[model samples]
Target: MTVALMWEARAVAGRGEELLAWARDQGLSVRPLRRETFRAPGDRVLVITWWDAAYDAELPELPEPEGELVTRPVHRWRFESVEQGA
Candidate 1:
Protein backbone atom coordinates (compact mmCIF):
# COMPACT_ATOMS: atom_id res chain seq x y z
CA MET A 1 0.00 0.00 0.00
CA THR A 2 1.00 3.60 -0.44
CA VAL A 3 0.87 6.03 2.45
CA ALA A 4 1.22 9.77 2.49
CA LEU A 5 2.18 11.79 5.53
CA MET A 6 1.39 15.43 5.83
CA TRP A 7 3.22 17.90 8.06
CA GLU A 8 2.15 21.51 8.34
CA ALA A 9 3.28 24.51 10.37
CA ARG A 10 2.88 28.25 10.58
CA ALA A 11 5.94 30.37 11.17
CA VAL A 12 6.19 33.45 13.33
CA ALA A 13 5.55 36.82 11.82
CA GLY A 14 7.96 37.87 9.05
CA ARG A 15 10.01 34.70 9.36
CA GLY A 16 8.41 32.77 6.55
CA GLU A 17 11.60 32.51 4.55
CA GLU A 18 13.52 31.10 7.48
CA LEU A 19 10.76 28.61 8.15
CA LEU A 20 10.69 27.53 4.53
CA ALA A 21 14.44 27.05 4.54
CA TRP A 22 14.27 25.06 7.75
CA ALA A 23 11.62 22.75 6.37
CA ARG A 24 13.60 22.16 3.19
CA ASP A 25 16.69 21.28 5.21
CA GLN A 26 15.02 18.64 7.38
CA GLY A 27 15.97 15.03 6.70
CA LEU A 28 14.23 11.77 7.47
CA SER A 29 16.25 8.74 8.54
CA VAL A 30 14.14 6.57 6.27
CA ARG A 31 13.74 8.42 3.03
CA PRO A 32 10.23 8.51 1.56
CA LEU A 33 9.36 7.34 -1.96
CA ARG A 34 8.59 10.98 -2.75
CA ARG A 35 8.60 14.29 -0.90
CA GLU A 36 7.29 17.74 -1.61
CA THR A 37 7.14 21.04 0.25
CA PHE A 38 4.76 23.94 -0.12
CA ARG A 39 4.09 27.38 1.37
CA ALA A 40 1.03 29.62 1.59
CA PRO A 41 0.26 33.31 2.16
CA GLY A 42 -0.24 32.86 5.88
CA ASP A 43 3.37 31.84 6.45
CA ARG A 44 2.20 28.28 6.54
CA VAL A 45 4.45 25.51 5.30
CA LEU A 46 3.26 22.07 4.30
CA VAL A 47 5.29 18.97 3.53
CA ILE A 48 3.99 15.73 2.10
CA THR A 49 5.90 12.48 1.96
CA TRP A 50 4.86 9.31 0.18
CA TRP A 51 5.93 5.93 1.46
CA ASP A 52 5.48 2.29 0.56
CA ALA A 53 4.04 0.79 3.72
CA ALA A 54 0.90 -0.39 5.45
CA TYR A 55 -1.48 2.20 6.83
CA ASP A 56 -0.69 1.27 10.42
CA ALA A 57 2.99 0.68 9.92
CA GLU A 58 5.52 2.71 11.85
CA LEU A 59 7.23 5.39 9.79
CA PRO A 60 9.59 8.28 10.20
CA GLU A 61 8.17 11.77 10.19
CA LEU A 62 9.48 15.30 10.35
CA PRO A 63 10.15 16.57 13.84
CA GLU A 64 8.88 19.76 15.33
CA PRO A 65 10.88 22.91 14.76
CA GLU A 66 12.21 25.05 17.60
CA GLY A 67 9.48 26.86 19.53
CA GLU A 68 10.89 30.27 18.69
CA LEU A 69 10.48 29.68 14.99
CA VAL A 70 6.76 28.98 14.93
CA THR A 71 3.54 30.48 16.22
CA ARG A 72 1.97 27.19 17.20
CA PRO A 73 2.55 23.47 17.32
CA VAL A 74 2.77 21.61 14.04
CA HIS A 75 -0.08 19.56 12.58
CA ARG A 76 0.28 16.16 10.94
CA TRP A 77 -1.92 13.61 9.22
CA ARG A 78 -1.55 10.26 7.48
CA PHE A 79 -3.54 8.69 4.68
CA GLU A 80 -3.39 5.54 2.61
CA SER A 81 -4.03 5.60 -1.10
CA VAL A 82 -7.30 4.19 -2.46
CA GLU A 83 -8.00 2.54 -5.76
CA GLN A 84 -8.36 4.89 -8.69
CA GLY A 85 -11.38 4.81 -10.92
CA ALA A 86 -10.83 3.53 -14.41
Candidate 2:
Protein backbone atom coordinates (compact mmCIF):
# COMPACT_ATOMS: atom_id res chain seq x y z
CA MET A 1 0.00 0.00 0.00
CA THR A 2 1.12 3.51 -0.76
CA VAL A 3 1.36 6.19 1.86
CA ALA A 4 1.37 9.97 1.89
CA LEU A 5 3.93 11.95 3.77
CA MET A 6 3.22 15.58 4.38
CA TRP A 7 5.99 18.00 5.15
CA GLU A 8 5.68 21.48 6.52
CA ALA A 9 8.59 23.76 5.91
CA ARG A 10 8.27 27.05 7.70
CA ALA A 11 10.46 30.09 7.29
CA VAL A 12 12.75 28.22 4.93
CA ALA A 13 15.67 29.95 3.37
CA GLY A 14 17.67 28.79 0.37
CA ARG A 15 17.89 25.22 -1.06
CA GLY A 16 14.14 24.90 -1.42
CA GLU A 17 14.24 24.33 -5.15
CA GLU A 18 17.17 21.98 -4.89
CA LEU A 19 15.51 19.72 -2.33
CA LEU A 20 12.27 19.59 -4.30
CA ALA A 21 14.06 18.70 -7.48
CA TRP A 22 16.24 16.10 -5.82
CA ALA A 23 13.23 14.36 -4.31
CA ARG A 24 11.50 14.23 -7.68
CA ASP A 25 14.57 12.91 -9.42
CA GLN A 26 14.71 10.17 -6.82
CA GLY A 27 11.11 9.23 -7.82
CA LEU A 28 9.09 11.02 -5.18
CA SER A 29 6.07 12.61 -6.77
CA VAL A 30 5.21 15.73 -4.82
CA ARG A 31 2.17 17.90 -4.88
CA PRO A 32 3.05 21.33 -3.65
CA LEU A 33 0.31 22.85 -1.55
CA ARG A 34 1.71 26.30 -1.28
CA ARG A 35 4.92 28.29 -1.40
CA GLU A 36 3.97 31.70 -0.10
CA THR A 37 5.97 34.62 1.20
CA PHE A 38 4.88 36.56 4.22
CA ARG A 39 6.21 38.95 6.86
CA ALA A 40 5.56 37.94 10.44
CA PRO A 41 8.73 38.92 12.26
CA GLY A 42 10.49 35.59 11.68
CA ASP A 43 8.36 32.96 10.01
CA ARG A 44 8.51 34.41 6.54
CA VAL A 45 7.35 31.57 4.32
CA LEU A 46 5.61 28.23 4.33
CA VAL A 47 6.15 25.27 2.01
CA ILE A 48 3.94 22.20 2.11
CA THR A 49 4.83 19.10 0.12
CA TRP A 50 3.03 15.79 -0.20
CA TRP A 51 5.13 12.75 -1.16
CA ASP A 52 4.34 9.09 -1.51
CA ALA A 53 5.91 5.59 -1.71
CA ALA A 54 6.97 5.85 -5.34
CA TYR A 55 10.08 7.48 -3.91
CA ASP A 56 10.96 4.73 -1.48
CA ALA A 57 14.63 4.03 -1.11
CA GLU A 58 17.08 2.22 1.07
CA LEU A 59 18.19 4.62 3.77
CA PRO A 60 21.84 5.41 3.53
CA GLU A 61 24.44 7.70 4.98
CA LEU A 62 24.73 10.67 2.65
CA PRO A 63 26.81 13.78 2.62
CA GLU A 64 25.56 17.24 3.36
CA PRO A 65 23.46 19.05 0.82
CA GLU A 66 25.48 20.75 -1.91
CA GLY A 67 23.99 24.01 -0.67
CA GLU A 68 23.33 25.06 2.88
CA LEU A 69 19.85 25.29 4.33
CA VAL A 70 19.18 28.29 6.54
CA THR A 71 15.99 27.03 8.11
CA ARG A 72 13.95 23.84 7.92
CA PRO A 73 10.60 22.54 9.07
CA VAL A 74 9.93 18.95 9.99
CA HIS A 75 7.55 16.61 8.25
CA ARG A 76 4.28 16.53 10.18
CA TRP A 77 2.37 13.40 9.32
CA ARG A 78 2.22 10.10 7.47
CA PHE A 79 -1.09 8.85 6.11
CA GLU A 80 -0.86 5.20 5.24
CA SER A 81 -2.43 2.86 2.69
CA VAL A 82 -3.41 5.41 0.09
CA GLU A 83 -5.46 4.24 -2.87
CA GLN A 84 -4.59 5.35 -6.37
CA GLY A 85 -6.78 5.87 -9.44
CA ALA A 86 -10.53 5.49 -9.85
Candidate 3:
Protein backbone atom coordinates (compact mmCIF):
# COMPACT_ATOMS: atom_id res chain seq x y z
CA MET A 1 0.00 0.00 0.00
CA THR A 2 1.09 3.53 -0.75
CA VAL A 3 0.23 6.64 1.21
CA ALA A 4 0.02 10.24 0.00
CA LEU A 5 0.70 13.03 2.47
CA MET A 6 -0.12 16.72 2.25
CA TRP A 7 0.25 19.64 4.61
CA GLU A 8 -2.08 22.65 4.86
CA ALA A 9 -0.61 25.68 6.61
CA ARG A 10 -1.78 29.28 7.06
CA ALA A 11 0.55 32.11 7.91
CA VAL A 12 -0.09 35.80 8.15
CA ALA A 13 1.98 38.52 6.44
CA GLY A 14 4.01 36.18 4.24
CA ARG A 15 4.11 35.52 0.53
CA GLY A 16 3.55 31.96 -0.60
CA GLU A 17 6.98 31.99 -2.15
CA GLU A 18 8.61 32.31 1.26
CA LEU A 19 6.73 29.32 2.58
CA LEU A 20 7.45 27.46 -0.63
CA ALA A 21 11.15 28.13 -0.24
CA TRP A 22 11.12 26.72 3.24
CA ALA A 23 9.24 23.63 2.14
CA ARG A 24 11.56 23.24 -0.80
CA ASP A 25 14.58 23.32 1.49
CA GLN A 26 13.15 20.49 3.52
CA GLY A 27 12.30 18.60 0.32
CA LEU A 28 15.95 18.81 -0.62
CA SER A 29 16.69 16.47 2.28
CA VAL A 30 13.70 14.22 1.83
CA ARG A 31 11.98 12.33 -0.95
CA PRO A 32 8.37 12.70 -2.11
CA LEU A 33 8.15 16.15 -0.58
CA ARG A 34 6.91 19.02 -2.72
CA ARG A 35 5.01 22.28 -2.58
CA GLU A 36 1.54 21.73 -3.90
CA THR A 37 -0.88 24.63 -4.06
CA PHE A 38 -4.56 24.77 -3.32
CA ARG A 39 -5.95 28.26 -2.71
CA ALA A 40 -3.76 31.32 -2.38
CA PRO A 41 -4.36 34.98 -1.74
CA GLY A 42 -2.00 37.72 -0.58
CA ASP A 43 -1.38 36.15 2.78
CA ARG A 44 -3.51 33.05 3.05
CA VAL A 45 -3.53 29.74 1.16
CA LEU A 46 -3.33 25.99 1.32
CA VAL A 47 -0.06 24.10 0.83
CA ILE A 48 -0.15 20.45 -0.13
CA THR A 49 3.11 18.62 0.45
CA TRP A 50 4.42 15.12 1.14
CA TRP A 51 5.70 13.77 4.45
CA ASP A 52 8.44 11.23 5.12
CA ALA A 53 8.31 11.76 8.86
CA ALA A 54 5.87 12.73 11.55
CA TYR A 55 5.18 16.49 11.32
CA ASP A 56 6.40 18.49 14.27
CA ALA A 57 7.33 21.37 12.01
CA GLU A 58 8.97 24.52 13.24
CA LEU A 59 7.43 27.64 11.73
CA PRO A 60 9.41 29.62 9.21
CA GLU A 61 9.84 33.39 8.90
CA LEU A 62 7.10 35.41 7.28
CA PRO A 63 6.91 38.89 5.81
CA GLU A 64 6.61 42.15 7.73
CA PRO A 65 4.32 42.12 10.78
CA GLU A 66 4.65 38.40 11.10
CA GLY A 67 2.01 36.25 12.69
CA GLU A 68 2.22 32.97 14.53
CA LEU A 69 1.71 29.70 12.73
CA VAL A 70 -1.71 28.13 12.55
CA THR A 71 -0.98 24.56 11.60
CA ARG A 72 -4.02 23.13 9.86
CA PRO A 73 -4.96 19.50 9.76
CA VAL A 74 -3.36 17.80 6.78
CA HIS A 75 -5.73 15.90 4.48
CA ARG A 76 -5.19 13.51 1.59
CA TRP A 77 -7.24 11.63 -0.98
CA ARG A 78 -6.43 8.01 -1.82
CA PHE A 79 -7.16 6.55 -5.20
CA GLU A 80 -5.65 4.64 -8.06
CA SER A 81 -5.95 6.24 -11.44
CA VAL A 82 -5.95 4.74 -14.89
CA GLU A 83 -2.69 4.28 -16.73
CA GLN A 84 -3.50 7.45 -18.58
CA GLY A 85 -4.15 9.11 -15.25
CA ALA A 86 -7.56 10.42 -14.41
Q: TM-score, each model?
A: 0.94, 0.31, 0.41
Per-model lDDT:
0.95, 0.38, 0.42
TM-score leaderboard ranking = 1, 3, 2
Instruction: Using lDDT, rank the candidates from best to worst.
Output: 1, 3, 2
Best by lDDT: 1
Worst 10 residues of 1 by lDDT: 77-86
Clashing pairs in model 3, backbone N/Cα/C closer than 3 A: none
Task: Report residue 27 deviation for candidate 1 (angstroms).
Answer: 0.5
Clashing pairs in 2: none
Give the residue spans of candidate 2 off by over 4 A: 10-12, 28-67, 80-86
Give the number of the best model, judged by TM-score. 1
Cα distance off (Å), candidate 3, residue 42: 5.4
Q: What is the lDDT of candidate 1?
A: 0.95
- lDDT per residue for candidate 2 within 1-86, as digits (tens), equals 34444444333455556454443343223333322222333433222333334446322211223444426434344455546577
Indicate whether candidate 1 or candidate 2 has the larger TM-score: 1
lDDT of 1 by residue, 9-85 (tens): 99998989999999999999999999999999989999999999999999999999976999999999999999757
